[model samples]
Target: PRSEVGDLIVIFRAGAYGASASPQSFLGHPPPIELTIDGDEIL
Candidate 1:
């Protein structure tokens, strides 16, 4: 599947009340600041 041609929903498993260890996506570092999923960007 192409990364751009689909809807991406990032659900942070971390709690919203308690202090999170990392307020970013656990998938990687420098978490996603902004994301734009466009099929045009897909190769």
Candidate 2:
């Protein structure tokens, strides 16, 4: 565990409790980035 302590990882599809799911703007949250990973057209 010490060897991987500095590494940064992202967990996707973990649950529906994500901020971008719903009621985000009402709580003064910024808009999340929408990614379109179509081949090299990753936007």
Which lDDT tens digits does candidate 1 get at residues 1-43? 5566456655544345322444665556655444333555822
Instruction: Please provide, for model 2 over 1-43, each residue's C-alpha lDDT reduced to its tens digit, 9 standing for 90 to 100.
Output: 4548556445555466554576767668776554434567875
lDDT (CA) per prediction:
0.47, 0.57
TM-score of 2: 0.32
Best by TM-score: 2
TM-score of each: 0.18, 0.32
Q: Give the clashing residue pairs of candidate 2, or none.
A: none
Candidate 2 segments exceeding 4 Å error: 1-24
Error of 2 at 21 (Å): 8.5
